[model samples]
Target: MTFTAARVIGALMMAGLGWFVSDLVRPLMPESTIFGWFNHVNLGLGFLIGWAMLGPKAGGGLMISLANGLTAAFALATVGLFTQAINEMLRLSTRKMYPNPLRALEDIFRILADYGSVLLHPTVIGPLIIGSVVIAIIVEIANSLWR
Candidate 1:
């Protein structure tokens, strides 16, 4: 389905705000606390924010919201992965001689592989799926009632 301008803007805002908030709070919180469900919460917040801004005007009902939320989650994860890769690269560079392009690429891939495992962990995936489903149901009901 197509995303309206308002829905797109809302989703971007949600993702940006979520990332900003998560980054701000991540350092203050324990790693154990932020490891699994942080992305899920950010995604849920994205969907809620988008829905709140666009309401019935966004169209496509629950499915759209679910799709958008998942998209936002993936986006967040990708950004996190890249950020991790960059940080790792910089840290390594500081210790070693300058890395060639190939070495840098390899380092990024390695970091991505490591982060991928974390992303796919049951604790992370389970909560994200459950949360998205619950949010979708609630959005469906709200949209139905509003119409």
Candidate 2:
């Protein structure tokens, strides 16, 4: 497939995968799991799914980042889009600061986006993170099993 086709397909696939995982998770925990440390799974896996499927040869990172941002749009027309935008922006900016300041900022944004829920809700910021990861891992295991 061409670069454009691959990118679109990847983004769509990841969006479906993300939605599926998030929906599966919606019932497992209370509505409070918003801290977001583990929320990166959506962003990470979504990006990887897109990169692996639709990304072009050279400018792969940019395509993945853009696809990730688009996934946010597909996710829903809500506050999360803004957060995802910021996350993608921070991630792009910090590409050079791996393992340092850049990464730290990216992590903070990811956490905030996941749990920026309410002003003072005692959020399970941790559960969402942990739960999401566990669930994503299960999905991955299932994918492997099927493959």
Candidate 2: clashing residue pairs, number: 4
TM-score of 2: 0.29
TM-score (all chains, Cα) for each model: 0.52, 0.29
lDDT of candidate 2 over 10-108, digit per residue (tens): 445544545544444445445654435334555455555444533332233443444434433333323444555466556556565456676666666
Taken over the whole model, the C-alpha lDDT of each candidate is 0.56, 0.44
The superposed Cα distance between candidate 2 and the true structure at residue 139, in angstroms, equals 18
TM-score (C-alpha, index-matched) for candidate 1: 0.52
Error of 2 at 86 (Å): 14
* Model 2 lDDT, full chain set: 0.44
Residue by residue across 66-107, what tens digits does model 1's lDDT show?
A: 775565456555665676566666666778845576787678
**Model 1 lDDT at residue 92:** 69
Task: Check candidate 1 and list the clashing pairs.
Answer: none
Worst ten in a row by lDDT for model 1: 50-59
